[model samples]
Target: MEHMEQYSITIDGRTLTAWEGQTIMEAAHDAGIYVPHLCYLRGLVPFGSCRVCTVKADGRFVSACTQPVTPKMTIENDSEELLDLRRSLIEMLFVEGNHFCMFCEKSGNCELQAIAYRLGISAPRHDYQFPERRLDASHPDIFLDMNRCILCARCVRASRDLDGKGCFDFVGRGRGRRIAVNAEARLSDTVVDVTDEAIDVCPVGAILKKRVGFKVPIGRRTYDLEPIGSDLEARRRPRAAAPTGGAS
Candidate 1:
């Protein structure tokens, strides 16, 4: 059997070696370049819904989380075109979703909110197309706010990969799209365990812990104290090494 290729590539003008099959965002993180992202959950398949981590490679806009690293490829991490696209995506996320920062419990700590601030997005330029959504707080600890969801599908992927339970899936397409529980059951009724890991996997306040809803003041929240990427990187533990004699 042929092995998956591995190669060295350059990102943000920095050269690094990585497996060819690994996504560019994974390679960037390994190199400490800190490309922004929202829908990418580690150990899960890339959903490419958030579009905050779009980068220019070979003169095209592609999601870094889904784009595979090519040997000797040149990646522009913060090019003008890429940054503009990112800003536009962030703005769209702000307006498309029911992200009322002033009233949100994750006002300061949200990944979506932090990336917007990081990119100098003062406020959304377009009109707020507010859509009415029901909040599913029936669960004992997990809160599923459909209005705030960007439909990033991190929760869906996490349910399948890390949790070994495919409880969540995308329900619709395009504008009416949403992440829904399997068989249309409420999240509280799913067979899967709603651990903090699932909550942490969410990039926005769509899913949160009921216990800590109002515990931290908005002024003292996470991103208010540290950058979003910094907090995420801190959570990055080392991957386990491969076995030495693995039938190579």
Candidate 2:
């Protein structure tokens, strides 16, 4: 692999080095900082749909996933204001989509749920939208439940970019937006396979394999083990304190 140039950037109070063209989130991740995000997966291109990764860069708020870092850039993450904003956004998602998380299959494994837990969002402050949604179980091996969908575009990007099949896409506009398969009306008409990345990439219970009764017992799932971003936080190699001059 070619060596990319690196430089320094400040987050909160600490300074760290980052790749030349990496997004702010990427740089922060490399430095063991966990910026909460939903639409920014590691491998696929960074989609800034979910603004939960918002940060203050040089005093201007920006999405860390899409905002590329610059030399000497100073970023504000985990501030009280930013935390409240993220918490509010998460709460809105919960109420807008009727995310009855307690009964949802993706409760523990869902990124939305995990992020909400990490942000200490016990309940949303907004009124529930209760938008009516559809559910499709026409496929023999897959199920589509729009109720759990956050419209993060992970499935759309995965299907088109990684799987090389433009099976999943968005239809409608504004609050009427939804995931639409290339099929005539249902996923059974599309060429989506059980093993496709699109099926596996859904961060919520929206897209799931059929006939696989929840095998993983509760209390052992992904977020159940730890709060979201704990893995990256663990990856951080603690910086040793600077040496005191002559023991003062």
Candidate 3:
């Protein structure tokens, strides 16, 4: 493959080299810089709906997941204003649904919950919409709890792109928009398998596998033990090589 162009960009005052074709979030992650995001799963195409990854690119705010980095671009990711805005977006997601983590099956292992913790959000500031969603346990091995869905579309993208099964897609418009099964009213009427990527890619408890509930204990679940993106933070800004044997 032709070499991807590389150039420097500054995020939150830190300088990091970024490759061409990489979005702001991608470049930040490559440098072990944690840019909070949901609805932007790696491997799948970036869907900038969530807006949690919004950052200022050269003083113009844009969704980092979709905004490609440019040479010498100044991106403001962790500014107080940006953090406050991100927190608001996340809070809205929480309130838009009935996300009762204490009662939800995906509580501890949920990416949405994990991100809330990572961002230090104890509770949402926005009022709950509680849009009167319902459950769809029609599938023999899967549970579709619409109440917890933040509409991140990770399931939609994963099913379409990763599993090669377009079993999930959005239907309706605006507030009425919701996930729909392929050519079916319910999941049981669709072709979704229990092991499908769409089922596994749900960031929240919206789409969950059944029959193995509570398999992960309360205190030992992923994100329960560590903040999300801990792996990337562990490698934060891979140290510049030791200067090749103590200075030239």
Q: How many clashing pairs does model 3 include? A: 0
RMSD (Cα, Å) for all candidates, in order, is: 4.3, 6.4, 5.3
What's the residue-level lDDT of 30 in candidate 1? 67
Per-residue lDDT of 112-155 in model 2, one digit per residue for the tens?
99998899888789998898999999999999999988889999
lDDT of 1 by residue, 1-248 (tens): 34655566777776676664678887777655778888876666777877888888877788888888778888988777777888888899888878888878877878888998888889888888898877887678788898888888888877777787887888777787878877566777877565635567887888888778678775687788777678546654343122111111
Candidates in order, TM-scores: namely: 0.85, 0.93, 0.93
Clashing pairs in 1: none
Model 2 segments more than 4 A misplaced: 1-3, 238-248
- Per-residue lDDT of model 3, residues 81-143, tens digit only: 988898888898989888888878788888888888888899788788878998989989999
Model 2 worst lDDT window (10 residues): 239-248
Q: What residue runs in model 1 are displaced by over 4 Å at the alpha carbon?
A: 1-6, 183-185, 217-220, 231-248
lDDT value, residue 188 of candidate 2:
95
How many Å off is the CA of 235 in candidate 2? Answer: 0.9
Candidate 3: segments with Cα more than 4 A from true spot: 239-248
